[model samples]
Target: MSAPDQLLVVIDAVARRSDGESVRIAKDVLCAGAAVKLCLPDTPAEFAKALARRGSRRPVVIGDDRALVRAVGLLHRGRELSDGALSLVPVGPHGSVDLAGALGVPLGAVAAARAVLDGAARRLDLLVDDSDGVVVRGLRVPAGPSGLAVIEPGSVWDTCRSLVRTLVRPAPSVPTIRTHRLRVEADGRVLSDLDDPVEGVTVLSRGGVAEVVVRPRAAEPVRVEASAVTISGASFRYRADALVTGPVWTRTWTVRPAAWSLTLPAA
Candidate 1:
């Protein structure tokens, strides 16, 4: 398809802070001469509605990483991810837009918005889990005595405590780290057996395969590449993208090559 000249700007509620910077970014997009339809969605339902009504306009998400994930999930669910490319303007506190940075999106609102007007669409891979959860970046299965801590969003006290601990304490030692006995399978082959104690596991989709890295207690890390991976153990938690999930026995993720497209500055 040809490049989109009409755009749909969806601003998440959280990014509506900072003296209406999200709105100003939309205005900047409009001033650049693209036909823009701006929507300030305050809730998840509203966000869905706005996207559903996007018509032919290309979508530009104005918010943090979660907002981008929400839009991508909606598009993927609607089977429209391959139909058009999505753009993003990272609008939040300094460290909140890490995903955008990782995806090569300009950090500034104006630059990201302008990229929507004059950028190239690049197809990217995605990790689709068994439950249909999408992971854009990657995931980690922590190793330690406690394993991975469950961090719920909007818990101010928990956030403060964690922050304080990080600032005050020395780095955790290997013995203090929680370890789990996980069975990791990559494309049907077992990379790590359940009998082995693992320090951590990380998987990232690169090229057309999922790069699986298993860190064992006293051995060099094991790395493998496959299109699919399955992790099963007694009960473990994993951090997928920016969300933490599970205490479940098994979770499988398949790599979808070029599953989605994003607009990024031209090389």
Candidate 2:
């Protein structure tokens, strides 16, 4: 007999693939019966509420990376990260689906849904930001790019083409080197103070606390261990996965390990 179905999907209409074609494609693949209850959420909060109500059901998000990040953030905040699986169908602006690629989700909506249905569930790490925002991986921001911002709206065809091109292109290097006087504390120890100027710092941890800074002169990812960390900076923004957030001056992040799971292909 086939395994019992235990998957639920919630979608954000404002995010990527909010059009008719993408939606139809997702509905055709992911929402085909009593196994999956596909919900079209008008807002992120509503989606979160629906997800919280569906205990034990795996979450399959059908939007861009930002939508996926939002779902992850909700789980982290709800303290239910270790319980279920989260999958994605990346349908958004170009470069917005980088996190999906990192998580091994296929580019096409139907293929991604299949991966969710047939892929193996694996434990994955999460990065909690200063504002209590949680991400599956590191954040990225490009400094010297023109005509790359997602603010300007484009046609569906144009957006689709751009998304394809971005996924195939080489990862661009960060050009502008901006520094921040950051105060980072891990566990109970101070890793860096306000006096030091650093380009960027990545706080890495599977569960407990591990941090590494990407400075101008650093040889490799320097290890700094702690149970929790706090970062404070001035007038600067950082990338969280594919989204850019905050000039948030001070925020505290606590390490939560094995906080989430994802379906992956066998290695």
Candidate 3:
């Protein structure tokens, strides 16, 4: 379709602060000379409904990083991402909208909203996992032991006894970082074997390939470019964009080249 003349501005509840700076900036900039439909969604269900009702208007999200992810997930699930260009006006406490900043969206509410009105559409790559989840920034699979620690004691005496035991235990002779055994594949070729312990794995969608980097415990890092990547091992958790998902045994992510477009400042 032709460039969008009307816009659907979906402002997340978190962005609707008492100060209202973000909302005001977005409305003023976007509604200056265009037809705009503004929506304030208090809940996820309301957010979905607002998007579903956005007829031909291009969507502009005004909120933090999570809010951006939510809107993108909805559009991707509905199969409308590729054709519609998205805009973002990140609003929240400082550092809360890092993803938007990383994606080239201006961080200032006024500047971001202005870009939404005056910027150009740039098609960007996306990472789509087997579960149909989308990753906008990147994905990281951490190595070493999971960071979660749990403590349980029957009573105050039990807690004291456990603490005394921990205080008396001998320390290790040599401190070493724990590593995980993972099988990593890129475009069906093995990049890391399960026999090798890995420190971590990072995957990013760049151009038409997935840039895969595998950090081994003792060897030089291995980097490869492929159209897809698959990782299998004991249940492992991964951080995708701004969210953490898994404890999954295996997961595959493929590169969707130029899968969606975003509005950003003109070069």
Candidate 4:
């Protein structure tokens, strides 16, 4: 079979160490008897421009999780995510699991890279924040660890002890769980106005909403049957995956169906 003639590929340098092997593998498998241009991008802006200006071809990114997210974010905001196709090679340690897990990228860099060359794209769900930042699955937000959970702060001796403990022992646990006072509105109707902080709220389409997951203290899953949703809170900040954006009193969010297309291993 003949390989496609036009392909646009970008790699992030920061994510290079983790992605280096995969990048090489992609080049090896993809470039073999094929015409291709692989670019190593230093900044997200450059990647965005390259992705936008790409000529009649799908875009592939080789970098850590952030690189993949950034690429998606750009396409989403440019109104290109729904129409554009994306391929990912996990490179960085941080956020790598989240990225790979969400996108179904293989753990091995080479395997992930190979998926790009051979994978097929499918319409999928994506979350958009106030800034239109894109998150594949969801976010994790927790309140700071309580002071008693750690050594005392004032006394020099306590400080020394705390420092040692901090070095040797794990840091205080940031609450893995939280609930937010959310006012969820789908389409235009209010679905919830919970006063208690409930588990994370997911605003997706009907089919997407059916996939909603609530944690230990599960609250009533608010059905957001609309094309858009709005979330607000005064106590806790929101974490979109690894990116923390809002402590706002309120923020609006929307779910656009098939807003992004991701390349996946054919079934």
lDDT for every model?
0.83, 0.67, 0.84, 0.62
- Candidate 4: C-alpha lDDT: 0.62
Clashing pairs in 4: 64-92, 139-241, 179-197, 179-198, 180-197, 180-198, 187-226
How many clashes show up per model? 5, 3, 0, 7
Give per-residue CA lDDT, model 1, range 147-193, as digits (tens).
Answer: 22445568879889989998998876654656789999999999889
Q: Which portions of model 4 miss their true places by more than 4 Å?
A: 1-4, 140-206, 210-227
Clashing pairs in 1: 144-177, 144-178, 144-179, 145-177, 145-178
lDDT of 4 at 218: 57
Best candidate, lDDT: 3
RMSD of 4: 6.1
lDDT tens readout by residue for model 3, 13-120:
888873387678778988885688999889999999999999888998888877888888888999989767889998866656878888999988778888988899
Candidate 2 Cα outliers beyond 4 Å, as residue runs: 1-4, 15-19, 32-34, 129-131, 140-177, 187-191, 204-211, 217-227
In model 1, which runs have C-alpha deviations exceeding 4 angstroms? 1-3, 143-150, 153-175
Top-down lDDT ranking: 3, 1, 2, 4
Candidate with more favorable, higher TM-score: 1 or 2: 1
By lDDT, is 1 or 4 better? Answer: 1
Residue 159, candidate 3: alpha-carbon lDDT: 76
- lDDT winner, 3 or 4: 3
* Tens digits of lDDT, candidate 4, 220-253: 5543244455655555565554455545666655
For candidate 2, write residues 1-267 as lDDT tens digits: 133366677777765344557757876776563277778788777888888887667787878877888888887788877776777777876676777887777888777777777777777777676667875676432122322354434567888898999899866686645666877666656666777766667755554455555453333434576657677767555566666666577766666666688776545
